[model samples]
Target chain A: MATTTMAAALGSGLRRAMEDDPRVVLLGEDIGRLGGVFRVTDGLQRDFGADRVMDTPLAEAGIMGVAVGLAYRGFRPVVEIQFDGFVYPALDQMVTQVGRLHYRTGGTVRMPVTIRIPYGGGIGAVEHHSESPEAYFAHTPGLRVVSCATPQDAHTMIRQAIACDDPVVFFEPKRRYWVKGSVEDEVLDDALPLDRARVVVEGTDVTLVAYGPLVVTARDAALAAADDGLSIEVIDLRSLSPLDLDTVETSVRKTGRLVVTHEAQRSGGLGAEIAASITERCFSLLHAAPVRVTGFDVPYPPAKLEEHFLPDLDRLLDAVDQVMGRQHSLTGWSA
Target chain B: MLRSDVSDGRALPTTEEPPDPELVQLLAPDGTRRADPVYDAWVEDVDAERLLSLYEDMVVARRFDVEAVALQRQGQLGLWPPLLGQEAAQIGSARALRPDDFVFTSYRENGVAYCRGAAPVDLVRVWRGNALAGWDPWAIGMATPQVMIGAQTLHATGYALGCAKDGVDSVAVAYFGDGATSKGDVHEAMVFASSFAAPVVFFCQNNQWAISEPVGLQSRHPLADRALGYGIPSVRVDGNDVLAVMAATRVALDRARRGEGPSFIEAVTYRMGPHTTSDDPTRYADPEVREQWAAQDPIVRVEQHLHTRGALSEDRAQEVKEHAEAFAMELRDATYGMTAPEPLTVFDHVLVQPSAELERQRSQYAAYLAMFEGTSGGDE
Candidate 1:
């Protein structure tokens, strides 16, 4: 075992995937000579050659359409959009072609295309670079959407997503890419399936559901709540589309209080679906209605305002406090 | 008018860029065979028997189009995009391809699909709303026809790129129309194909119209000229002349197979019928102009050429027509007999392994369906 960042873990996973399957290929802009803007695919081109690690033209639709075609011809393509905001150009190809081909062809054509997007705000980048666009992909029916919180999950899930026969939209939390953690070289066979949710920090008073960049914040919030004699459970939802509602329901059944959180706009976001679904499933067992701590229903704010916009530990604890019927942390940027 | 050249009865409009005088023409509209030093050698092996077979292919394709349109009109099909007057362009180029060469085409390439060995019933499976997929693409080496305009061009480029990486010599061919050249996907496809030197053939049958829009709106010059901007060689062929189309396709296929990168072909043709069964060509196309194009019919020119050469007898042509009629009748029967698929089958192919959410929904749907089963029948 060696300590590594989420980015390095992803690189190792990609290397392992390519080493195991000759049919696995990578396509993205600047991925060949530049590794990647975030360096998640660093040194891959030097080892795998330019043909396997392709530096595609600066066209997202072209990259996506080409990836779908590669999948059509029995190649598993792992494509990278430079950032989450730029994925819009390829959304049509993903939703219309990549997602539908398998369904359209009645299971004969499998779209084993893994699209990686460095998403969520953390780096002090410009407007388009740090946006969270998971809701768009999660709403798309044919795609399997996922997000990795820790380096270990990132390492394991990246390979699993590449090997999956269906198209997967993988969201990498940009904020956590460089956060270092210990990782094992060999993945255990008993590792959780790519779509299951895991409880990162367990407690009893309330269950706090989070994913991607906000999982760490939820964990921190749970730790903080423990100091005050309040127990909070933090659940890291790995898959966003086929939500592991059974695990969540079990946690909610124990806690009887729920809080859902994300960095996207609260309106029509994954939080709304989680809150409504949890309410419907565990209504009789609940003590209070599920509270959603999410970003505002507006465009992702500028860099200076992002810290306030993003769900921090204090803000998440506020939602947990509200569900626990305790004195809450004030809910605003000033707090 | 489908094109600005409707009044002149020519395929290209009189723009700042005129039609290339070097347009490959082995057979003119008047049934005169012209010998070209460059392309004539490509078609030398097209003997009288092969020519007759090519003519029969076009004849049968035209029959299929006529029958599909009739089926749509009779409500047996949801919609049909008629490939009228472009039979030679589709069949001629498709016949030039080896079975291993994959084809990515727009929804209008039923003729190419047929040549790729798609069954007649499979062609209408999607149109009849019976199934999401009509046939297995792997079995035919052709993808399910793409409906998003010009998108398949990118797929062709991508597939060829993969083939190059795998060291496969087989080429990927993209079939689209004049208006599709205006799409960003086509431009991106050419750029990628050229930049990577991927073995791709962009076979564009410029049918002079995109629904109601004229080709002039899509291009100021001949569509073939646009290929030069991307560092790819191009050819403009008489789409009505089956031999000319075959020669052009052979040249492109040869270039692609030789690892010389991509090539483009603009098969200039006209749409003699409505864009689909729902369209009314009379709304925009003038009768006199349509008559002028009718004189240059792709199948008619082949028939005239065969008659002038005495290569095929009238009895032989009649037999082929009878054969096509019998196939059309079979198509009608197959279409009428197609049963509606099970309602629950919609959830079958969404994923290789159904997710937990999908599984719950499928079971709930099954239970809901089960609710109606025993309550309805006296036999129960």
Candidate 2:
């Protein structure tokens, strides 16, 4: 076992994939010699040569479009989008081509491609750098969307994503890149299922569902709630698409209350979907309306205000308090 | 007018004898008999059975195209991009491809789609709003018909690049219109194709107009000549001449399979119909221009030449017409009988795994749908 940050885990995972499969290639801006701006791909080009670790032109659409072709040739391309907002230029290719290629081709072609984007706010980043756009990909069919919170998940999930026959959007929480954890060096023959949620903590008061950067916040909130004599169950949704709703349903059924959280805007966000699904499947079991503790319904604000804009431990606990019919005001509380 | 600089310096070498320079005429206008020795060798490979099959394919595709336009007129389809005059260009090039070759096409190549084995009924789903795409492109080794201008060119180039890496003998052919040459992706595709020496054939159907924009606006030189700038050889043929288009495509495909790299062919044709069912060409084009192109109709030339050669008898011609009509009727029945996709289908394929967000949206949408259903007594 080795202790590593999320970014380092990603680099190790990418290196393993490249070593395991000759067809596996890396393509994106600043992903080659520079090892990407975040250094998630550091040392990859030096180890694998330039052909395998390609630094593509500053065209997102071109990168995706070219990757589609590369996949057709039996190459597994892992593309890195510089930022969340910058991925829009490649949206057409992602939606129209990558997401639909398999079904459109009657399952004859497999787009074994992975798109990696560091998303969500916190750490005072500028516009376009910190934004949660997983919902957009999760909304597209024929694509798998996943996010990693822990370093272990980041390493294992990246490998799982590269091995997937379908295209996958791997959203990495930018703020969690520095967070460290123990990573298993030897490849596990059986890793966690790529599409299921993990119950990080067990509780019966309220089901706290979160992913990516929000998972850390949710776990912290749940710990704080524990001191307040509230057992807040925390679920880390590793996969955004093919949502492990069974896990959510089970947790929601037991707790009879659900509070979903993410760093994206509230309106029509991933939380909205989670709330609706839980209400439909676990309707009679719900103690109160499923609430969402998410980013405000506005563009990602400036660095200084981002902390307030993003869902925090207090906000998550407040949401829990509201759902459980407790005093909502945190005015006099000190953690 | 055809530009001189585009034509003057870029003519095919004269010494080896160009492939039937007489427009590669298999059938001539005015019902006359004519034969060129250059293409005679290739024509021998096209036996009586193959010739009849080619004719049948063209007829069926043309009928399908015509019926689609009618369907659009009757509001059965939202719109139809008619490939009326350009049937021969598509049919001829499509026939040149083997089953192993892959094709990436622009949205207008309905004829090529038919030849590639997509059912006529499948085409209706796209225009009828029942599906995002008509059929599975991979099943037929054809990518989905790309709607965005010139985007497929880059895809085709990438496919070709992959083919090179795999050392596969298969070549990828990209079908686009004259208008697509103006797109940055197309230019970039050309650059990539040339730089990598990717095995590809860029088949550009120069149909003279891009919606309201004339081909002249898209290029100052011939569309084929634009390829020469990238160190790729290019050919321009009378797109109305099916034989010429077929011959040119065959050569390009063969060269690509042999690892000779990419080639571009500009099939100079005319779009005798509107840009789409919703468009009105009368607003932008001259009546005289249409009249002139109509006189040079692709099918008419073929029929005239076949009749002169005694290869097409009056009875055989009648049989072809009857078959075409029967095919059209069968397609109409199949297309209209297709069921509109279920509303829930919208939520089904969005992702391989349902996300918390998607589940939420799906449930909310279902609730909204239920409210309407309840109010309308399940009508929705």
Candidate 3:
């Protein structure tokens, strides 16, 4: 075990997967010599050789389409789409071919392709670079969409996603690439399943559901709420598509109130799905209507306005306060 | 794009693109066998007996296509895309492949599927709208017919990359139409195949149309010329001639297995039917042009060649016809007997491991369906 950044942990996890399985290969643009745009694949090429760590041409559709073939050929190809915005060009292959190949073939084949996309915003980046597009994949039936927050999950889940038999859309929180945490070198046999949510903090007044980049924000909000005498439980929903709704439902039932947070637009985001599912499963246990804190329904703005656009501690707390039926409090810390 | 009334005397292609004077041909259109020194050597093993077998395969595939089209017309099938004129393009290339070599083809590859040993029943389930896919891709070493244009090319290339990485000698072949060459996916696939030196063959049956659009509209040069830009060697062949297609495919597959990276083959042919049953060819296709291509029929030329060689006796012709009729009837019976799939079976195959949500939804849907099990019709 070692303390490392999410990026390093991800690189280590990929290295481990490749070492353990000869069929596991990594393919993407600049992932070889440059070790990917975020350095999430640093030194992998040198260790595993170019055959396993392929540096493909700058073609998103080709990357995904080829990965489908590789997967069909019985290779576990983990493709990197570089960034959140760059994934659009490959969406056609991912949604049409990769997602439906198994079902279309009536289970004759399984596409064990892991598509890694560094997603979400708040790095003060330009247009297209900073956006949340997980809903588009979660909406795809054959795909399993997931994201990682801490170095531990990043290390464990990335390998877990690779080990999975279905096609997985792994969204890495680009901004949290440098967030340092302890990552166990070896995955425990009793570790959580890749699709279940993990309760990062324990409390009772209200439940804050978040994943990927926003989990840190929700944790901060939970910590801040403790000061106001309102105990808050935070749940990191690692998986988005086959949502760990049971975990969220259990938390909602205990807390009797819920606040969902994400970087995606609130209108049709994962928050909406969680809120609806929780309402269906925990309607009798709810003390108030579920609330959500998310990016507005607009194109992601320029980097300068990202702080305002992204859901932060204040925004999460504001939703928690609303869910608790409390009046607005001006006693929050200044930016 | 200007319209021309009474546009006779215009060239068939209607473009200034340079003609492929070197289009490979092992048999002339008039039943006479012509020899090309380079390609003839590749098909030297194809004797009179193999030629007869090829003829039977094409005949069977054509009969199956006719039955499928008739079924569509009779409202038995939702739709059918007939591989009417390009039989030799699919059969020749597919037959040239080794059993382990994989195939990723477009929707118009029923002939290829037949060559890969797919059963008649396995070929029509998806067309009958009773299944999502037609056949087991692994069992036949061929992927399901991809409806999305040019997407399979990338898959073929990636699979070839896998083969190369695994140190396997098998090649992956992508069968697409001339129109697919215009897609970005095809171009990107060729680029990757060349860059990685992947063992893949991009087999394009240039049937001269992408739906209603002319191949001229899709390319300024011959489709084979596009591969040169990607640093891949390519060949253009007379698609109507089965022997030439087989020879060219053998050459390409050999190159791929030899670690020579990827190669492209543009089989020049014409689609002798509407794009699908839903399309009306009279709306866009010129009857005069259709008549000209019909004279270059792939199957007739092979039959003519066999007759000239004294290999096609009256008894042999009768046997082939009887076999094709039997296969077509079997296909008809299988398709007619197919039942609607269980509605709840849709819950399967979405993932290797069923998720909690899918299980919950399956149970809920089962309950919803069960409510109607004993319900009677309402009275007025």
Candidate 4:
């Protein structure tokens, strides 16, 4: 077992996929010599040479559209969108072409293009850098969307996502790049399926669900709640699109309460869909409606006021308290 | 000042643009043959039989277009983009490509599809609402007809990049109209193609009108000049001349296959029909300009050239007419006889392996369908 940061794990994951298949080509801006803005692809260009690892012109649409073409020519293209907020320029290609190719072609042409984006804000960056835009792609029909919170999950999930025979939108938590964990070298845990939720901590009172950066926060919230005699179950939802709702439904069935949290805005967020689906699935079993701990429905605030904007242990704890029918915050106070 | 900038309105492209001296032409409009110094050797292999075959291609493709428009008008198909006047632009360039070369095309270019061996059924599959894909990409080396303007240029560039990496000499071609040149995707495609020196042929058929808007509204300079700014070798050809178009495309294809990087060709043609079955061209099209272009039709020029070469016997002309009639009949029959697809198939092929969530939804939908099956009355 080797201890690695999320960034290093991602680098190794890319390296492994390239080593396994010659068809895998990496394309992005500043990725060749600079190793990308976050260094997730550090030393790849040196090892793989310029053909497999390409420094593309700085155009998100061109990068994505080129990736689609590469896939058509039987090359497994791995594209880096650079950042989450900058992906809007490539949305038309993603939705109309990448997402529609397989269905439109009646399964003859498999996309197999892995698009990586360093998403979410907690590093106190400026506008467009700190936004959570997973919902836009998750809501799209043709994409498989996932996020990795830990180094181990980051390594295995990125590898599996690349190996999959469909287009995958792989989200990496930009703030959690330095987070470290022991990665079993080149080993993928068979028990932890790609489309299933992982139980980070098992408890009974309320289920606290989160993914990406918030998984670590929710785990801390559960530990803190444990000290207060509140048995909170923390589930790290790895896949966002075909959400491992079976795992969430099972947890909700057992705990009888739930809380969902994310950095993205509340309206039309992944949390809203989770809450609604659980309400329908475990309606009789639910003791209280699933509570949401999320950012307000506004643009990601300026860097200075981000702490107030982003959800942390305190907010998640409050959501747990609300779902558990306990008095914590926002309880029966008339303003 | 803004009012004075426009005398009548947006600059309507005049038919009398002082006959372009730079335009490459092997066959002139009046049955006259011009010998181009550089391109004459390119088409030295085109004998009497080869020239007649090109004439036949133009004839058959025009018949297919007429049939498709009639199908759309009769409510048998969803919509059809007619390529009435640009037959040479499509057939000439497409015939120059090898079978291994891939093509990414716009919604029109039924002639190109014809050259690529697309059956009448395959060509009209999407328009008849029978299927999303017109034909398999692997089989024909061409992608599904793209409706999004200028999007496929990037695909062609990227495909060329892949071909270069795979150590193959097959060229990747992109076919679009003049209006598509103004799109951001097209601009980005050029930047990427130029930066990587990808072997892509950007074939833009300057088919004067984009719906009701004229090409003058999109670009002031020649479309080929726009490509020249990107450092890609550019050429302007007389689109109505089959031999000229064939020569230009062969030059571009040869350059790309020789690993000399991308080339751009602007075939200046004219759109003779509405943009689609739904558009009304009479609103904006100039009758006088249309009449002037009528004398320069793509098929007429090819027929004139074929007659000069002693290739137009009465029996052969009758055979070509019969072939075109048969082509139109096949499309009409196949379109009318298309089988309806199953409703449950909508949930299929979204993923290589359907997720458990998709399976659940499919089952739920199946149960809903079961309810109607069990009842006496059903909603169709």
For each candidate, report its DockQ versus the true two-chain complex. Answer: 0.84, 0.29, 0.86, 0.84
lDDT of all predictions = 0.88, 0.83, 0.89, 0.89
Candidate 4 residue lDDT tens string, B1-380: 01123345664443223145678988888767898799999999998899899999999999989999999989999999999989999999999999999999998988999999999999899998877889998899999878889999999999999999989999999999988999989989998988888989999998887788777777766888888788999999988889999999999999998888998999988888889999998888888778777778888877877788788998999999999999999999999988877888998888887988899999999999888984777555
DockQ ranking from best candidate downward: 3, 1, 4, 2
Write one digit per residue (lDDT tens) for candidate 2, span A265-304.
Answer: 8888889999998899999888999989888878889999
Q: Give the TM-score of candidate 1.
A: 0.96
- Superposed by TM-score, candidate 1 places the C-alpha of residue A277 at a distance from the truth, in angstroms, of 1.1
Candidate 3 chain B lDDT trough over 10 residues, lowest sum: B11-20
lDDT of 1 by residue, B112-141 (tens): 998999888898899998886778999999
In candidate 2, what are the lDDT values of residues B1-380, reduced to their tens digit? 45333435564211111122434455444434346565555556775556666777778778888998888788788888999989889998999998878899988998898888887677777887777678776667788788888888878887887787777889899999988998877877887788768899999998888997777667766678899998899987778777767878888888899988999998877898999988998888777777777776777777666655567877888888888888777767866888888777676654444455667788988887788765756755
Better of 2 and 4 by DockQ: 4
List clashing residue pairs in candidate 4: none
lDDT of 4 by residue, A305-333 (tens): 99987898988877777776775565542
Give lDDT tens digits, candidate 1, residues A169-279: 999999899899988766636688888999998889999999999998898888888998988889999999889999899999999999999999888999999989999
- Candidate 4 regions exceeding 4 Å error are A186-191, A328-335, B1-19, B374-380
